[model samples]
Target: MKNIRNFSIIAHIDHGKSTLADRIIQECGAVSERELTKQMMDTMDIEKERGITIKAQSVRLDYVKDGEHYILNLIDTPGHVDFSYEVSKSLASSDGALLIVDAAQGVEAQTIANVYLAMDNNLELIPVINKIDLPAADPIKVAEEIETSIGIDATDAVLVSAKTGVGIRELIDAIVERIPAPSGDPKATTKAIIYDSWFDPYLGALALVRVFDGEIKKNQLVKLMSNNEEHQVLDLMYPHPLKRQKTNAIKSGEIGIVVLGLKDVSIVNVGDTITDAKNPTAEPALKYEPAKPFVFAGLYPIDTDKFEELRDALNKLKLNDSSLSYEPETSIALGFGFRVGFLGMLHMEVIKERLEREFDLDLIATAPSVVYHVYLTNGDMVEVQNPSELPSVSQIEKIEEPYVKATVITPSEYLGNVITLLISKRGMQDKMTYLNEDRVMLEYSLPMNEIVVDFYDKLKSISKGYASFDYEPIDFKEGNLVKLDVKVAGEVVDALSIIVPITSAESRGRALVKNMKEIIPRQLFEVAVQASIGSRVIARETVKSMGKNVTAKCYGGDITRKRKLLEKQKEGKKRMKSIGKVNLPQEAFMSVLKMD
Candidate 1:
């Protein structure tokens, strides 16, 4: 236990955290160079294609220093804000963290956010400057920025190029020297905290846990602290990048996989404690709160017959990803579906893509919305997750929308453009500070709904990809919010409804109707696309009827004959307009996502 080092790599997205992990693994001789692959920690294809780590992975390595053999357990964490919960859990199981900052980009928004998380966990921090091989790499400037902004000593920061394996030996040596070894008692009763879990068809549910006290061996009876469910441990193995090595037992201050022979993955919950069933301890391991979702949206199948399949898919996915939550819901325009909640827009996109790719199901996702507190006139409070479920104005008193404290880090050259972008999104400046002469950090309070859509994309565009953003939910505040509904030919399209601030509802509605007119195919009769707020139409667009010149049949006919034909055609059009039904394409349901 004294020679065991548990640590995790934390950094902002695209900062080469995964590459660093690969290099460290290679340096530790965990795998040979010929067998090694780029981003070995990223096991998912989506992660490789997107160049991001979606899941947290763990690996154990053996390193010898000064003739002393040591066990190094490294947890590779996701860098995106959406996956912060994973990072927190990884930190909970570690004694220290390797803070990797890009050499050129310096400290980014996520870097700052993750630093606070590590500090909150009281984990020792080791600063590491990555990508030193880049032509524009400036390790000195980044180290200075870290010292000034994070108030951490970075003079001795490890400088390395993960791609070329330069300075990897020095980083390993630093890890062995700087990170404190895990402290626990092997003689105590078994108590372990599960940081992550997944379903295995052959072995049933498997839990990845860090043993804090005592030992767990094969065929031992164990209990889950969360639900008090008891099961026999069928097997144990050490976690590796490529394969799991069978172990007779896992001792204190070590990470390993536990198999209970349970087919249902829900039985093995993440963040739950595992203890001896017969000789249980009085106190369980430290409990960690699950990640709460910030955005909610409805996912309906394009084919209504797949509702049950969709439900099964979500259930299976939840077994692997505990953060995903869904409940059965039905829409008037769209048939039966589920109202799914996600951490952010990227999280939602990943889930949707997974469902389509893994389960082979086509899905239609409604516009994402934030949770709103509705104070009814009848002295009742209701939480609204779907815009179509918003109560009528007559039944409500006031609406409160969720807000977030957002932090934006960028170069000083784009400070003006960033401020303008935030202000347009109804953001109020909360604070501002200069990390140095070239970098600025700005804080703002913005409504969650405003930033939940295309805020990140727009911010990146305006700042020319030099700005990074991160936000956390704050308390809900009273806002002049209204439910904007779209009516196509006098019928409300529930899927196209949204909640918007009163000030921007008119413009948003007009833009939505204009986009609808361009995308919605014209019918035989004129179609009216109207945007309304509480039965009052605010914007309208008319899709002209597909016309056929009635007078063309009689080009040289008399004036009276032409007049009669024109009148007949007019009457026919009026009848068609009354009875025609618009067949909206899938693009119509997705228009709201692209609406500015």
Candidate 2:
């Protein structure tokens, strides 16, 4: 245990966390130089393409220091704010963290957030300034900023270039010397924390756990503390960047993977405690709160016949991602589908992409919305997850929308633009401080709905990609909110509904109809695309029918004959308008996502 070091790498997105992991793995001889891949810790293809870590991964490394062998368990974590819960879980399972900061970029919003999380977990911190190979590298200034903003001693911070493999050996040495070894009793009852899990077609659900007390061996009957369900450990294995190595048992202060051989993946939950079923411990390893989603969206298959396939895919995905939650729902425009909840917009995007790519199903996702609390005049409160389910304006007295406390770090040059953008989103300034002479940290409280849309993208655009943003749920606050419904040819399209503030309902409705007009194809008859708050339509656009000259067939006919033909054609159009159903393309539903 004294020679074992368990730690995680935490940083903002694109700060070389994954790259640093690759360098360390190479330096420790975990894998040969020829076998090493860029960002080895990021195993998912999507992660590599996006240059970000979406899932947490762990690896066991054997490092020889001064002729003494050491066991190093390094966990790689996602850097996006959407995956903060995953970061917390990784931190909980580690004894220390390597705080990676981009030397040129200095500290970011997510960096501060992750630092606080690591501090809360009581993990030893090793600050490492990465990207020193860049021409604009400023390690000295960055170290000073970290000390001033995070209040951590940066004099001992490790300076390294992850891309160039510089100072990697020094960083590894720091990990072995600074990070404390895991402390637990091998003789005590079994107690392990399941930080991550995944589904295997033949082996069933595999749980990635950190053993805190006692030892977990093959064929041991272990109970999940979350539900007190017992499952015999079919096998044990140590995680590797390239592959997993089989192990007979994993002792205290060690991290390993346990195979339960249970076909039902739902039974294996992350953040659950594992203990000996026969000799149960007095308490679980630790208390961990389940992840809560902040954004809600509907995922419907383009072909309704594939709904079941999508469900199965989601279930299989859920086995690995416990944060994903969904329920069956029916849409008038979209047909049968599931209303899925996600941690954030990026989370939603990742899930949608996975479902489409992994399951090979074409899916349409509705506009993301935040859960609203509706307090009706009847003294009853209801939670509205879907905008279409919102009560009528007459049925409700007050409506409350979830708000978030957002933290933004930006250069002083873009301070004006950042503030203006926040104010436009109905943000209330909470506090502001200067992190340095040119960098400012601004705090604001804004509606989650505003942030759920394209707020992050807008922030980056306004700041010219020089700013970083992070947010946390604050609380539900009363707002003059109303459900905005989009109607196609006098019928409401439930899938295109959204909740918006009354002040912007008219303008947003106008935009929705305008975008819909551009996307909805022309029918045989004129179609009225209307946006309504209730029975009253606030905005409308017309999709005119393709012109037809019925009178041309009777070029020289009498006036009475032409009039009769015209009346007949008019009557036919009226009937067609009544029965004509508009077949909107997938792009029409997506248009709502772009509504300002």
On TM-score, the candidate that comes out on top is 2
TM, every model: 0.95, 0.98
- In the range 78-191, model 2's lDDT, one tens digit per residue, is 999999999999999999999999999999999999999999999999999999999999999999999988999999999999898899999999999999999999899999
User: Residue 429 deviation, candidate 1, in Å?
Assistant: 1.1
lDDT of 1 at 176: 89
- Name every residue pair that clashes in candidate 2: none
lDDT of each model, Cα atoms only?
0.92, 0.93
Model 1: lDDT to the true structure: 0.92
Tell me the deviation in Å of residue 340 in model 2.
Answer: 0.9
User: Candidate 2 overall Cα lDDT vs. reference?
Assistant: 0.93
Q: Tens digit of lDDT per residue, candidate 1, span 1-596?
A: 88999999999999999999999999888898788999999988889999999889999999999999999999999999888988998999999999999998899999999999999989999999999999999999999999988999999999999999999999999998999989888999999999988777798888999999999999999999889999999999999989789999999999999989886666777889999999997787887887788999889999999999999888778867778888999888888999999999999999999999989999998889989999999999999998888998999999999999999998999999999999999899999999999889999999999988899999999898989999989899999999999999889999889999999999999999999999999877889999999979999999988878888878685799999998998899899888877877878887887888
